[model samples]
Target chain A: MTSRRIESFVGHGALILGALIALYPFVSIVRHALGPAAGSNAAGPFTLENFTRAWVGGGFSHSLVSSAIVAVGVVVVTGAIASLAGYAMAMLDVPWRGAIMGVLLIGLVLPAEARIVPLYDMFEGWGLLNTYWAIILPQIASSFSLSTMWMTTYYSALPKELTESAAVDGANSWKAFTRIVFPLGSSALATLSCLIFLYTWNEFLLALVLLPQNPAVQTAPLSLSFFAGAERNTQPEVIAAAAVLVALPVVIAYAFLQRRFIQGLTEGAVKG
Target chain B: MSLGHRDVAAPEKRRVAGRALRSRPATRRAHRLRTTAWLYLLPGFAFYGAFSLWPLIETFQYSFYKWDGITAAKWVGLKNYIKIFTSEDALSTFAHAFTFILFYAAIPVVVGLVIVGVMTRVRIRLLGLLRTVLFIPQILAMVVVAVAWRWIYAESGPINAALEAIGLDSWTRAWLGDFKTALPAVGLIGTWVMYGLCMVLFIGGSQKIPRDLYEAAKLDGAGPFQEFMAVTLPGLRGEISVALILTVTAALRNFDIVWNTTSGGPGNATLIPSYLIFEGAFVTRQVGYAAAASVVLTTLILLLTGGIQALLRQRK
Candidate 1:
């Protein structure tokens, strides 16, 4: 018993150390954002000046709203498309199921880095560059495969008898889907929405390339990058404050919905 | 005799009526079902084709030409591909990406295994909190991570302060700015972001293993290390493959972290393929060259992931 107690003690000690290492950067960022500049004494004299400075200088007020717009657009677009396709594949008698599945699987593996250059030219040709459409359109496309696959799996797992019974009540295919299949998949939709929100929120490269000269349209992360580089020398506190602001919403959302997020993320991993 | 004749004739008429009524609705329902399915797929396919599939084909076609974003194009053929292979900077960048596989893939898997092995035996509390804390990195924007780490590695940053306090002040410098340590410093950040994922995957995998196997190992006088080798490692093969594919891809296609931190700077010490491709297309006006590099990078990613999947399948 004594030996077992010692072993548990050592294990907890190691775990606590690991947790500290994981959280140290966040702690440092919080401290720097609240305290004086680095060269000052380690103790008191904290201020909220950094948050105000970052809000104005970093242009996060505009960019955060922009990020929100892009994220919401991507989630709504992806959710609607994925659910429809998933229903067709899972619940309906769709021809060429193998071919459609093949295409989506290929899309799943194709990286965004591979296609960003051509996408830029295409958007330029269509007069869509520097617009929210440029970001939202590609984000919806890239995110489609995963969301579709996730919804397909989810709808497939549900009892088919529910939809089948709905069909016998004089409902057309569309009505059956809208009334029965859609409402039953609400939890799955929530999970997919959370995942899409996270991806679109944290996206950087597309936002950087598409909105290069326009801070008005730039997403929060991209704006933060430019803001940090431009103000690194003079405003360490402001940089930390801006970092917190950029990360805060996502962090809060994750805190509330982490169980769903984890389950959704690991769903593909387990199934594959 | 009259009643029997009437019964037979009426039954035949009823059967004919039923067949006529059923056939029309059945065929119509089949046709409607097909149309509905196609309608459901139409919007997804349209967007995917326009944005993803079409541009993917365009990327390949663009690699064969020497067109700038403007003006008429010249046919470059294999010249860009040759440059990607022959250029010193390009060659070193590819090598640097492969080196990252160590920190991003191998180290994370090993660390995850060790942590899981301990947790299996000791049953630590606050597992949920530990997982959430560790996964914080994976959720944050890479740009935020890069900025935060840059501060942490600054000259008067916390790292140096700690070193001075411990009386090892000579060892501290701007970690990301140094030519020697920049790539590894960047790679360590990848390590931190990735190990949590690996650990999460392994924990899930380990839980699926039967408890009896561990009991049998203990009944045979197997120690903790022996039991882990006999039961835990084999149980985790699937998770390890997944962790490898995800982390290796992240390491190779790592642009955001590298871009925000060093921009492949300090004299190209931390240069990787994605950054190179971006610079080639935008900075140098070498559209064909950049497209070719992208093609190669994509092929490399597919090959590595495919190989990992195949390797794991063979062992099974």
Candidate 2:
């Protein structure tokens, strides 16, 4: 009895400790953001002035809007493309299935560093640098690999009778897809959307490299980097506030859709 | 929810469709369906080809030429690749990236195994809540994580303050600024962001293990450690491979964290390949050299992931 009790205590102790370690940084930053603007009294009297400073002085208002636009644009386009291609790959008689999977696998495994330079040159050549297309187009292109893979996996797991019955009822492929398969895959779509939104919102390197010349297209994370860099010495509170602002949307999305987020990440491994 | 009923009815419905399809000209239908399928695939593949595949091929092509993104291209085959292999500074950058695999991949996987080992002994309550909290770091912008940690590691930050309070001021130098500690300090941040993911994957994988195995282990009088080794470790092979592939890739392609925190500073103590490629391409205008570095980095990622997959497959 005592040994069982000790094991229980030890397990709970380790997990709680790990949880606290993970949670501490955000708590500290939030406290710091609410503290006095000039000093670093982490738990000082709470105030909202730092947010206003970071929002207005740091140009976060504009950057956050830019982030929203870019994220939404990439999500909508990638979702459509992924759904169509994934449906064809899993259900329909898509030709060159092996070759297509090969291409996507290359995209999936290859690092972004491998192609960033040529992309830069290509965009620059077309005078597309600093445009929202410069960021959104490439993101959609790169995101296709993961998104299509996700959708294909989800669709392939469904019972074949759903589509077969629709076919017997004289429903064309498009009709069957629109009415049955797509609606049935809502949970999967929701999971994919959550993952894509989080990834797009948090994307940093692409934004930094592609959108530096245009303030209107710069993302919140990139802007926050510049904000924190300039104000690290003099305005730690504002930098903390800026960090909070940059992280807020995804954190909120994560809070409400935590299950979907977790499902998207672990589904592949768990099923295996 | 209807999947149960659909599973039973699937063969009947498939036969009906198969008969109806036989009434039509099969080859014509096959050709038409193939064409339609290609239509569905075209948009996605077109974008991927233009922005991803073509650029990737272009990177390889540009790697063989000496051009500043403006001047007439001079073909210098193998020279750029030779420099990466021969240059001390360039070689160290690759080494630093590989070093991150220890902190980012190996540490996280070990921590995850330890947690799983502990977990097998007792049931954890509020697991969903714990998972959400632990997984937050993975989703947050790396810039935000870096900003928050930068303060914690600052001279006047919590670590320094704690050291001063404990009369250990000598041990309180800037964590990110010191040459010897910079790489490890940065690498440890990767650990903090990564281990949670490993834990979650392992936990998810563990639940799929059959209860009979645990009962059998208990019947055989196995200790907790022995039970974990005999059952839990083997059950989590696939999850471990996924975790290793994800974390190792994150480590090797590490840029945003190093960018926001240190910018490969303090005499290039934290410089990695991605950072070097960025600097060479844009900042220093060594375009061809940067392309070669990127190709090397990409090759390394593919080789390592392929190696991990093969290793795990053999074990299975």
Candidate 3:
């Protein structure tokens, strides 16, 4: 009985310790974001002035717009394209299913850092520098794997005889797929779409490389980089507030789609 | 939700609409299908072809040339590649990246699995709340996390003050500035953020193991450790592989955190390949050399991930 009590005590102690480490950074960020307005306290006086200054005319507004443009572009173009490619792989007995999988999975391994320079060269050649498309186009491809992989899994689980029946009814393959496969894949699509939106919204590296230096075209994070003019003012509180603004949309979004988002990520482990 | 239920209702609509569509001509429908498929696919294809695939190929092409990105190109095939291969500084940057991974890969994956394993054994009242709190770091910007940590790691920061009180003042240093410790310091924070993700995956995967296996292990006088080895570990193979693959990839591409924190400072002690690539291309305008470096980096990731996939498939 004494040993069992000791074990329980150790277990609970560890859990509490782990929990505190996890929560500490968040508390720190919050503390810093609303640092005290006056008096020389390094930890601070606790005010909202930092947040207000960061949000109002503080140049994050441009990042908001740029990030939106790129994210929406990803959802509409990349999301839709991946659905089609996924549909093809899941349903059609194409001669190259394995090859297509290999191609997409190749992207799974290739990090943006490896390709950033090449992308810069291509965009410059095409005179696409400082344009929304430069950032949007690359991000769409990066997000393709998430969409295609999930959609294919969703589509394959669907009963095949339905499409076969539609074909017999002379609806042909496309009609059958649209009227049959697409509707069946909606739940999976919703889950995948939510993830894609969040990923493109949160993406940083590619945006920094591809977008223009112009204030209007720069993303929220990139704007934040140049905001204090690169290591001058050193306002950690204002930076945290700006960071909070950048993360706000995705946080609200995940709350709504929490179930599906978790499912999509854990699919390899649990569901599949 | 009604949406999930709506999907369950879709098959019935297909069934009802089937007979009426049969009266349509076959070839005409096939033609329409072709057009629709192409139409649905064309835009995405163009976008990826223009932006992603072409640039990948172009990276190889650019690596062979000496171009200032604006001026006319000069062909110097394989020279840039050879230089990077021979350069001590460039080689050390990769060594730095891999050294950081010692903390990033091993620690995060271990901590994550431990948390998940513990959660399974315990009946925590606020399990869901715990999961959400752990995941907060993944969503927060790297800049905020780095900035917050910078303060903590400062000489007079709370962390050092506490250490001094505990008679461990000798252990303190400017973590982000100290050449010896900077990479590990940044890497540890990454491990912290990532373990939460791993925990989340493991919890989902563990629930799927049949309860009978555990019960059988219990009847055989097996402790939780033995039972986990017999049941939990095997069942968790897929999640473990996924976590390893994802974490390793993130480690190789370690940029934003290190960028925000050190920027490869203290005399290039923290320089990783990504930082070097950024300097070569954007900052220095040695676009060609950066392209060569990028190709090498991409190839290394491909080989590593490929080896992992092979190992996982072989185990299966």
Candidate 4:
């Protein structure tokens, strides 16, 4: 009994220690963000001045909204497309399932770097360069592969009887999907939506390449990168504040949907 | 196009067997089913095909040519591929990427295993909350992570301040700045970001392992270490493979972290192929060379991940 108690004590100790290490950087950054800047006349240890300064100085007013637009667009479109495809693959006897699955598997393994150059040229040719479409479209494509795979995995596990009964009740495939499978898969959809939202929200490479000319369409991270590069040495606090602002939306979303986010991540890992 | 039609028709024809003229309504239903399935796939395939698949093919084609983004192309078969192998800078990017695999994948797996090993022996409270907090880092923008870590590793950053307070002043230096420490410092950031994912994955996978195995091992007089080896390690194979695939890919495709933190600098110390491709294609106008590097990098990623999947093929 004593040995068991010691083991439990050590286990909790190790977890607490690991948690502290995991959270230390975020805590330090947040503290730095709150503290008064160099040579600033703030009566207290904390100030909102850094956030205000970072917000205006970093142009996050434009970038954050821009990121939101792109993320929402990608999430909605990718979700719709993936659910349809996943439903078809899982329920209907889709011809060429193997081939389409092959392409998606390739997309899963294929890094973004492979397609960025040609995508840039294609977008340029289509006169969509520096537009939200440029960023949103490619991201949808990339996210769709995983989203379809995820939804397919989800729908496959669902009992066939759900659709079989609907078919006997004179429902076509589309009706069966809309009325039954789609609603039934809400948890999986929520999981996928959160995953897609996070992926699109935090994306940097595509925005970096595609929207180089247009600061209006530039993402929060891109703007923050430029902000941090310029002000990193002079004012670390403000940069910290800017970093927080850039990370705020996803952080908020994660805080609220913590269970779904973790479920999507871990479940995706196991099943991927 | 015709293959799908023939496939659907073939099955229907077989069901009728001797009937040369099938029921028109039944034939129509099969056609409708095929059309619906294709329709469901079309929207996704259109975007995926145009943006992802077509560009992928074009990337391979572009690798064999010499052309700026504006100028007319010139065929330069294998020249760019040759450069990736021959150039000192190009070769080193791959080496640096592999070094990151150690920090990102191998170390994290070991750390995760150790943590699981400890936790398996005892039930800890707030496992859910702990997992949520640990996982926040993985979900954050890499740029945010890099910026935050850059501060943490700064000259007057907390790390140095703590080191000084502990009377280790000589040990403190710019972690991301020095050549010797730069790669490992950057790599350790990968470790910090990835180990939680490994732990979370391992934890989730561990729960699915039947408790009977552990109890059986204990009944057979196995110690904690022995029981873990005999039961837990083997049980988490699928999770470990997944963690490896994800982290190793993240390490190799590590552009965002490098871009925000070092820009592959202090004189090219932390350069990886993804960063090299971006710089080469967009910044330096080595479009073909960039394409070649990406092709090689993608091939390496597929080979490594596929190899992991094959080696760790999960038993039914």
Candidate 5:
């Protein structure tokens, strides 16, 4: 009883400390984002200025729209293509399933940084640099794993009878797939959509390499790079608010899809 | 070995059977099933072939030629790869990966295990809130996380202010700017970013373990340590494999945290391979060399992770 009591006390203390440590940087950033700039009276003083500056100051409003456009484009393109690939993967008697799967598995292994060189050259050749499509198109193509994995899982779990029965009732393969399989795979679609959107939004290196000088075309994360430019003259308060603003949407999205997000990430790792 | 040969042989038999389709109605029906599948498959392959496969093949070809992403190809053959293996700068990037592995994987795994061990013992309230707070970082963009931590590590920043308050002012410096401490500082931010993921995985995996195992251990008068050793740890094996694999790969291809935090600065103290690839391609215009390094890194991750997956057996 005595040892258990002691252990419980130590465990609680450690747990609280660990949680605080896990949250240390976030809470610190929040404190700075809200804090008075050196010897101010109000608790979160000097900060409508910070918020205003963060919004208009960094041209974040434009970046916000640009980010939304890129993220949405990437998500839609990835979802549609992935859904097609995934659905087809599920219906495996298709010719070149072996060849196609082999190719995609290689795609899964190819890191974005590796491809940035060739992609930059390719995009430069096409005069697509500093454009939304340059970033979004490559990202959407990279969603092979996301779509194939989700679709395969959905299709694997789906009752084959529904598809066959629909086909038996004079429905063609496309019709059966659209009406029956698509509806059933809505959750997986939503999961993959969220994944693609987050991937597009969070992608930095490619965005950096592809769109660095063109600040107007920048996504939020790419835009946030301005604050970290090692320029030596940027202020902390402005940087803090900008960081906080960029993080807000993701946190909000996460709240809505928290369960699905966790499920997708955990399950995707196992399946992938 | 014969089975391997037989497996290859069977595919030919399948093709031959496929040709005799019209003679048998059942074979014709199967052939029709195959054709329908092709229609389903057409769009996906077209997209994959146009974008993914072509570019990937081009990437391999590019690695052999010394093009500055724009100029005439020099056809450097194996020189770019040989330089990658021999260069001190390239080796430093590998060193950065191992240095990151300490904070990135080792710290998180231990912390997560401890969190799980304690959660099993305590009847904690506000557990949901606790989980959310820890997890909030993982949801945020790496750019935001990286930038935020950068400010916190500034010379006259909160970290220094806190150090002053505690009379450890002498201990503080511009952490992210300090040459010696910069790599570890950037690495610690990775710990902050990733530990939440490890926690959630551990908690999820632990809750699924039959409570009776712990209950039985309790009846055996086992302490928390013993119960955890016997029950919690074993139960968490699957999630452990997952957390390790994800974090290890993240450590290898880590771009954002180091990019945004130090930019691998204070004189290349934290220059990782991902950054090297980025610099080689974009900054230096050594696209071919970058591709070679990328191939080597990808092959390394594939081998290491495949080994881990096989050794772990956490999957069916």
Candidate 6:
């Protein structure tokens, strides 16, 4: 009993230490962001000046708005399309289903880096560079495969009787989907939306390349890097403040919807 | 709810007319189902093809041509592929990605196993809170993570301050800025980002294992470590494969962290293939070369993940 008790103590000790280490960087960021401007030691007087400076200097107000539009656009578009595709794959009898499934699997595995060069060219050809569509369109494309896969898995796991009963009552596929399947899919939709939002908000490289000279279209994360670069010689607090500002919304969303976020990400992995 | 019921019932009114018109109602129903499925698939596939599939095909096509973003393209088959293989810098960048697997995949899995092992043996309180805390890094923007870690590794940053406090003042240096330590330092940041994911996966996997197996191992006189080796390890094969595939891909395609932290600097110590692709396409305007590098990188990722999947399947 004593040995077991001692083991539990050690395990708790290790877990606590690991947790603190995991959280320390965020703590440090908050400290530096809120603390005085001069030193790395976060013990000096606290001030809102760093945040205000970062807000104005980073041009984050505009970038944050851009990020919101992109994130929301990706989520809405990806979620709607993915859910439809998922419903088809899960509930309907489509010919060439295996080939479609294979395509989606390939799409899921293809890294964004692989297609980025040609995407830039393609978007440029379409005259979409520096436009919200450039970012939103690609993000939706990349996220669509996983989102569809997720919803397919979700729909497959759901009881078939729900849709079947509706179908038996002479309801068409579309009516059954809207009246029956869609209501039951609220959680899945929420999960997909959260995942898409997170991906779109955190995307940096695409925004950087596509919106190169346009601060108005630059995502918050991309803008934060430029902000930090411009102020490399300045106080660390300012940079920390900007970092916090860029990360704030997603962090807040995660805190509130952590269950959905975790479930969506891990479930995607399991399904894949 | 009433509206849903009415909608559901409304379709029944059309059933008599359809039944009276079609002698082969079953075939017609099947056709309708197929049509509906196709309709549902069209919008998703349209966006996917226009953006992802077409771009991927275009990347492969671009690899055979010599074209800047602006100038007219000249077809140069196999030249870009040959260059990617022959170029010393390109080779180093690929090598660096393999090195990152150590930090991104191996270390995190090991640490995750240890943590999960401990948690299974000794139940931890507030497990959800612990998970949330550890996972914060995974959720944060890579740029923000890089910025935070940059400050943490700065000359006057917290790490040096701690070292000075501990009388290891001589050990203090600009970690990311140092060539010798830059790659490993940046890779360790990946370790930090990924370990939570590994832990979460393993913990979830471990919970699915039947408890009786552990009890049976104990009854057979196995100690904790022995039980873990005999029971837990084999049980986690699927999760381990998933974790490996995810982390290895992250390691190989690691651009954002390297870009934000070191910018593949300190004498090319941390340049990964993705960064090279970006630099080639955007900075140096070597579009074909970048496309080749991308193709190679994608192949490498597929091979690694496919290899892991094959290994796990054989074990199963």
Query: TM-score for all predictions?
Result: 0.92, 0.94, 0.87, 0.95, 0.89, 0.94
Q: What C-alpha lDDT values do all the predictions have?
A: 0.84, 0.86, 0.71, 0.88, 0.76, 0.86
Q: What TM value does model 3 have? A: 0.87
User: Across residues A208-254, which tens digit of lDDT does each residue of candidate 6 receive?
Assistant: 87888888899999998888877886868899999999999998999
DockQ of each: 0.50, 0.56, 0.30, 0.57, 0.46, 0.53
For model 4 the local lDDT of residue A272 reads 47
RMSD in Å for all candidates: 6.6, 3.4, 5.5, 3.4, 4.9, 4.7
Candidate 5's C-alpha runs over 4 A off are A1-16, A35-46, A96-102, A230-232, B1-23, B121-124, B215-226
Top candidate (lDDT): 4
Query: What tens-digit string does per-residue lDDT give for candidate 3 at B244-272?
Result: 77777778778877777777887888888
DockQ of candidate 5? Answer: 0.46
Worst 10 residues of 5 chain A by lDDT: A37-46
List candidate 3 stretches off by more than 4 Å: A1-16, A38-45, A228-233, A268-272, B1-40, B117-124, B165-170, B219-221, B314-316
The docking quality of candidate 4, as DockQ, is: 0.57
Q: What is the Cα-based TM-score of model 5?
A: 0.89
Off by over 4 Å in 6: A39-44, B1-25, B314-316
The TM-score of candidate 1 is 0.92
Ranking by lDDT: 4, 2, 6, 1, 5, 3
For candidate 1, list the clashing residue pairs, or say none.
none
Quote the TM-score that chain A achieves in each candidate.
0.93, 0.94, 0.86, 0.96, 0.90, 0.95
Model 6 alpha-carbon miss at residue B273, Å: 0.5
Fnat of every candidate, listed in order: 0.58, 0.70, 0.33, 0.68, 0.52, 0.71
Q: Give per-residue CA lDDT, model 1, range A121-163, as digits (tens).
A: 9889899899998999999999888888888999888875676
- Please give the distance, in angstroms, between residue B164's alpha carbon in candidate 1 and its true position after superposition: 2.1
Give TM-scores of the second chain, every candidate: 0.87, 0.91, 0.86, 0.91, 0.87, 0.89
Superposed Cα deviation of residue B119, candidate 1 (Å): 1.7
- Which digits, one per residue and each the tens of the lDDT, describe model 1 over residues B1-316? 0101112336578556655766676667666777778899999988899888987788788888886767887998988889889999999999999989998999988988987887676665887888787677778888888888998888988889999999998899899999999989999988988887888888878888899999999999999899889999988888888888889989998898999889898899999999877887778877878888988998899899889888776264
Better of 1 and 5 by TM-score: 1
